[model samples]
Target: MKQSTALTIATGVAAAAIGGLFFYARATRPPVINPDVPEPAKPVELARYLGKWFELARHENRFEKGLDGVTAEYALEDERIRITNSGCQSGPKGERSSASGRAIVVDEGTNAKLKVSFFGPFYVGDYWVLDHGDDYDWSIVGEPSGRYLWVLSREAKPAAAAVEALLQRVEALGYDRWALRITRQG
Candidate 1:
């Protein structure tokens, strides 16, 4: 090819690369800290964190389909949050499945966020406490990417008003409410 033709092709490639980088940077950037995560005045006592927590709502995703009555049971095991999640399905009993994971607090003092590993070899995700009630009656949880969310409570179901309020809070954080799924409790 001629030198001018080669220069034009190289320029095109560089422009495309720069544009791609700009778009990705705009899309995936994390939220700037408005304020450091508040320290729990009295840390969440892990003993009460145990027991069945029904999935009152979640950010919509394809993986959890037909999994409405799901519950995540948390217990302290070896100083880690041992989690067992099980729920009904639209398939055979043999097809119904459960996942076990562990959560370890990333910061020792606040106990506000944790890293949970579900895959072997240990892939972890941020477990941010987006919102919580003083009585531990209801809580909103999400990850950094806004890819996962869960509305949890000790009761089998939460009031419609509570759900609406939680949705508003998440939306205020710039997450999408239209994509939220209200999971049916057992």
Candidate 2:
């Protein structure tokens, strides 16, 4: 009986030690942002960039939780860009929810960096196009802070190779690729 009790206690201690190590490793993981990296893409053409883009994958955020079939439509209005983002709450066939916003180019030379405001001027956020296809068929968007990310395409389902290439590009830009969640579109 004594030997059995000692073995049980030893097992419990070992389990606790393993659990603690796991937690520590997770907590000590490296951050996503790498300040040494350069700025986002340059010379984005506003004309070709306007239109609807389907969200293929993104880093989780509160505003888009439980949403699918997500898409963003951009329209050029004078010097600013008008934005309309929409998604389904349950799934691809679920109820639709949409929001309208505006984006102003911060750098006229590159037309890559922009400040977007969905809730008026007081709550603006960064909207930087980090990478995009030559034909404007796909784009990877993120912010200066590196907390948000989105992979969007002109089609509902782009080629797998295109998606994989985008993921690689995103990782090279210092974002956590593992945290990306694929979105369902229909």
Candidate 3:
């Protein structure tokens, strides 16, 4: 009886130690954005692309955690594109949060890729247009590193059919649909 009890206690302790290590490893590991990134689908017309856009979905990013009703507005300022990203923290009427940034065309011929800077010239990130609707109703934005992605629509609350179509396109582009968090529109 004594030997059996000792064995049971040892097994329990070993299991707990292993579980703790597993959780710690998970917490420290870097997030995997996407592995198999593809090429840009087509060129983007800057003029038509400049306007208010509603975020339909995005990867679970640390900066925008717990945010919903997100929106991004763009305007042309000289040679740069102005960016304004806003979102709600809680309910529909939650306090509003916003950040301003600027973007410059990386390629003049295509105008499909941009470098966005939120903190002056020192900070920048890739903003590549993976694909878009022919009529510019929706757009899929990603980076070369595949660490981030965003789906934007011209309408605040687009039709369900259109959203589904965009999601399918996103998946086809080697993005994981489960990693996308649908945003609530106001």
Residue lDDT tens for model 1, 1-186: 699999999999999999998898566644332223333334555666677787887765545766767788888999898989877685223244689999998866657678988886447878876667777887777765656777787777667788788778766666666677777765
Global Cα RMSD, each model:
7.0, 11.4, 10.0
TM-score against native, each model: 0.69, 0.79, 0.82
The top-ranked prediction according to TM-score is 3
Per-residue alpha-carbon lDDT of candidate 3 for residues 1-186, written as tens digits (9 for 90 to 100): 999999999999999999998898567543656787777899899988989899999987766887898999999998899999999999446899999999999988889889999988876889999998888889999888777899999998899998899999999999987788899887
Model 1 regions lying over 4 Å from their true place: 1-43, 91-96
Question: Each candidate's lDDT (Cα)?
Answer: 0.72, 0.87, 0.88
Candidate 3: deviation at residue 67, Å? Answer: 1.1
Report the error of model 2 at residue 140, Å.
Answer: 0.6
Candidate 1 vs 3: which has more lDDT: 3
Q: Which prediction has more favorable lDDT, 1 or 2?
A: 2
Model 2 per-residue lDDT tens digits across residues 1-186? 999999999999999999998898556543445444448755799899999999999987778887899999999997789999999988999999999999999988989989999999878988988888999999989876566789999999888888888889888877777888899998
Task: Using TM-score as the measure, name the better of candidate 2 and candidate 3.
Answer: 3
Give the 10-residue window scoring lowest on summed lDDT in candidate 2.
Answer: 29-38
Candidate order by TM-score, decreasing, is: 3, 2, 1
